[model samples]
Target: MNNQSKQPISPTAHGHRLVVETLNTHPNALRRLHSPGSAENELSELIVHTALHLDTVQKELVDRCTWAAQDLTRVATGTAAPNSLGVLQNSGLQIDLLAARRADAKAHLRSALAAYQRVTTIAKPQHAGPHPPLPSRTSPRTR
Candidate 1:
C-alpha cells in the first residue's frame, strides 16, 4: 500500500515556476525564433515589447513589496495594532513572502532587459557609416 499522499500545488507557485523557466530559456528561445528573413526583425520587435511589459510588472512588484514592508513596520511599531499575536505574525510572514517575490521579479526584469538589448543590437545595421552612393550604371557612350 502506497502511504505517500500527493500534495496540492498552488496556482501562484506553479505560475512563478513557469515564469522562471521561461526567463531561463528565453535567450535560446529567442535565437530559435530568428531566421534568414523578416522574422528576425519581427522577433526583435517582439522582444522589445516583452521587455517593456516586464518593466511594468517589475514596477508593480516593487510597489507591492514596499507596501507590504511598510504595513509590517506599522504592525511591529504598534502604529497599526493587530488584535492578536497571530495576526502580527501572519502579517510579518506575508511581508517576507512579498519581499522574496519582489527579488525574483527584479531578477527576471533584468534578464528581460538584457535580452532586449541583445536583440536590438543584432537588428542594427552592420555598417555605421553613411550609405555609399550608387554606382553609375550608364557608360560614357550611353551618357
Candidate 2:
C-alpha cells in the first residue's frame, strides 16, 4: 500500500481526540487521486492545522479580554453605590486574571508562529516541481 494510504495523525489527549477523528476522516478525498501531490498536500494540511489552532487560541484570548472588560465596566458603574467594595475587589482580581490570560495567549501565538516557520524552513518544497509551493524555513522572512 502507498504511504499516502497510511492512517491519519491523531492526538490521544481527551479534547484533541475528537479533532483528530474529524481530521482523519476522508483521507482519500484529501489525496486527490488524479493529482497525486502527496508531499504538497501534506504540507497544506499542516498549514491548515496550524491556522485552526491559532484561531482557537486567539478566540479564547478575546473571550477572556471581553469578560474582563465587562467586569471592569460593572465595577466602574456600580462601585459608587453602597456595599460595592467587595465586588470591586473581585472585579480587580478578574481583570488581573484576564491580563495574565492575554499574556499567555500571546506567548502561545508566538510559539505557534515559530512552529510554522520551522515547518516551512525545514521542509523545503524547492524541488517540488509541478506541485504546490512549500514555504521555506531555512531563514526568517522579512515581514
Provide the RMSD of all predictions against the true structure, rounded to 1 decimal.
13.0, 15.2
Poorly placed runs, candidate 1 (over 4 Å): 1-82, 128-143
**TM-scores across all candidates?**
0.40, 0.37
Q: Point to the candidate with the largest TM-score.
A: 1
Residues 50-118, candidate 2, lDDT per residue (tens digit)? 445544554554666676577777657985343445765675676576557545644554454455346
lDDT of each: 0.52, 0.49
Tell me the tens digit of each residue's lDDT in model 1 across 8-122. Answer: 3233333323333444433224445456456454654454444444444545556666776787789789898755657646656765676576566656555654665576577
CA deviation > 4 Å runs, candidate 2: 1-82, 125-143
With a 3 Å backbone cut-off (N, CA, C), the pairs that clash in candidate 1 are none
